[model samples]
Target: MLRIPTLCALLTLTPLASALELKPLALYQSGYPEGTEIVSVQVSSMRVIVSNSAQGQVDILQLDPAKGLNRIARHSLVAEGMGEITSAIFHPSDDLFAVCIRNSDGLKNGRVEFRAAADGKLLNTVEIGIWPDSLAFSPKGDFVVVANEGEGYVRDGEGFRSDEGSISLIDLRAGVAAAKHSLITLPDLAGVEGATQAEHKRLVERMIDGEELKIPFGTSPEHIEPEYVTFSPDGTRAYVSLQENNAIAVVDVLQGKLDKVFGLGTVRHAADILDDGQYAPTAELFALREPDALAVSADGRYLISADEGDTDPKIAKTKAGLPSGGGRTVSVFDAVSGQLLGDTGSQLDDMAAQAGVYPDARSPNKGSEPEGVVSFDAFGKRLAVATLERADALALIDLDQPAQLKVVQVVGAGEGAGSGKLAPEGLAHVEHNGRHFLVTGLEKSGNVALFELLK
Candidate 1:
């Protein structure tokens, strides 16, 4: 049995509407089209990059946290009909940036384009795989990772989907001026020691659509989709979130080998999820945690994941908009040991519910839907900020005690109704003018909301 250690800080469940406050200081609006959305937001020294999916452009906005946004520049990653931008990130030094653009040629090809951070001029482009959802920079500024989520195609007759997800490592030992690009596919990561290959095969060992297969869901080791990647503090290793596969891949960057892939087994004891399709006020809990966005601790000791679950395109949507398999939780892991140290189970969902920011309509499968995550050291605490998409809220977690994680605060409607964000996605922590703050990208509303982290 997986023992869930109690949160020593949360000796008693504090009623939600009361906790640390997350005052929304500002919201910057961009006139991108309705279909086009701000899916990802990455911050630099004094600028912000927002990836416009439908518009195929990456906008570099001059950011003044106290003020709003100034559109300093923008660049279209693809031709009018060529492709679209998936995600973007700036180099550690803030001199250059990169964007992963997926070609429109049947989701067949993708590329990582390097550009000048200030002028947004194209420097170079390197070929990668299909459907790159997210990317990241190494802390040492020597490499970048592109998570190519190869979402398969389907025909009317074909019963299952393709599993061609992968990750591309762009080595900049010689700098972006001259770089080497390499791929680390799901198949490559499968056999590593810490990986869950054997157990995953056993659990998924069944037939699908009358066809006898190694795994039932067309999701085997090779199909393990790479959704997001975060680097360790020292830049010697990285962790990739396989959202659908329910696994995390640890790569040794310096050695360029698979260090290990920690299999995050299903959440079996979650006690706060909404467990019915009625979208009722009543609530219960179940298990099944599939994480999306992930981050590493400053000391490189742990990894934090936002367990926002997902399903296939072939799967029908419910009235509540949830996947059949999902655990409304936040999980923490021992990076090197690949041991699941602890998780914030349905506590996040319970927090959202009490805050009244919980999206009842998105119950059962995705209660809070913690998506974007970022970590930093704040006031002597190893802290993390999680963006709850369905709940339209931001949560601050006290990670000082990794084994006994606590919900230090919840920012949502209960505290300040209209001040809350809607469908928040990406999260970034920043320090400027000797003050701490958080910046997030709001997808549904196309707004960038900023909050001052009051100590």
Candidate 2:
């Protein structure tokens, strides 16, 4: 279930906002198993929780600068029967938090976990859809939405196909009751542009593995992977990112159904800037707008996305030219209509190169690879932060304007000034005590980098 649209959009630039500086606070090492990386970070009024996949648990830490970072609680996800923890979210207005764990059964099952934010006491556990990759809580703490990324490795007749992606809406009003919610699978995306059987067939027909991995036509929805989710301001609706499908799904929570699927068009790289994957200021690669993470705008009218296009190396190597997939832009879209509201263009890539932290080796495929995004307001400025995994950096963007986004800061992931550790994956904007913090979980170095956003 996929659709292909013929019309492509060309974007224009807008004025940028006044740039601000990001001050480095400190890098706290996650003292888990060796190579046990920190994948997600969530901050609350009192605690900073991180999901460590290697250790298969969530580590709670104290973020008081006077005493430095200290491990306060470590909850075992597996011990709690929740398998490996992929992500966690703190309740918007309460002293509680939720965790999304992948069930040991892999593509077959998953779970949602709840605990006290202050003490890390296990309060409840509920089963959700398969391969729950991310979690989000409504503003009033009435529900928890889980992104079940049922990956594409399941059985398809005699061969294998993708697991149909679904979203689990667990009701929090009846606290600790596992049966109070609903699970909604997305409607087949076969009608959305580029998701049709004919288009999918044309893609696989190219001999990468010696032959086209053929399947029945008109079955594109199975290729989708629900990667991330963000709720509408009132919590009545949800905007979910379908990373592999290059689309976003809208769901009406109370109605509990997959409402609409919006196709995110591809990005045309400037004259050879990214074609060869070398570090240059020319557009060489045309990437698919496969958003991995999303943040709802302050007004709830737009959906801010980090298009960290994930292209397989084996697939790219098979082509002589840059693949016709992936996009290296930070974009915004109308939430309801799914209209293109403009994007950051190549500003992020250009700035990263100027900061001397650009991953030249990774430029060809996904220049910066923005994996995580979170939005927060300070004073009057509407701001969002994205974790650039390959570049090992954090990029902040001002999102108050309608057609433009200003690059606020480029926090490096190195030993230089204003830097964090390497391979920053998950990001969160939080207030601890009275200070505003932009926290990141480093995937490669196994550390947590904290930045104080200077107003």
Question: Which candidate gets the maximum lDDT versus the true structure?
Answer: 2
Flag regions of model 2 displaced more than 4 Å.
1-19, 33-44, 65-68, 79-82, 152-158, 194-219, 271-278, 313-323, 414-421, 431-435
Alpha carbon lDDT at 180, candidate 1:
89
Per-residue lDDT of model 2, residues 1-455, tens digit only: 11111223111222244645567787777764233333333443446777777776677777775665567877765664547777887676677678887876656778777888676787887888888888787777787788888753544467665567788988777666443668887777766773322353323221222453533323355556788988988898888888767788888877777888888876664522333433455445555677888998767887889988643432245255434445677888888888887777776766665565666555555667788888777657787888888778888788877486776666685464213237777777766565667777777777778787776
The 0-to-1 C-alpha lDDT of every candidate, in the order given, reads 0.67, 0.68
Candidate 1: worst-modelled 10 consecutive residues by lDDT: 312-321
Model 1, C-alpha of 87: deviation from truth (Å): 0.5
Clashes of each: 1, 31
lDDT of 1 by residue, 7-81 (tens): 542334543332345667776666752222233334345677777776777777766865756667777667777
Estimate the TM-score for candidate 1: 0.83
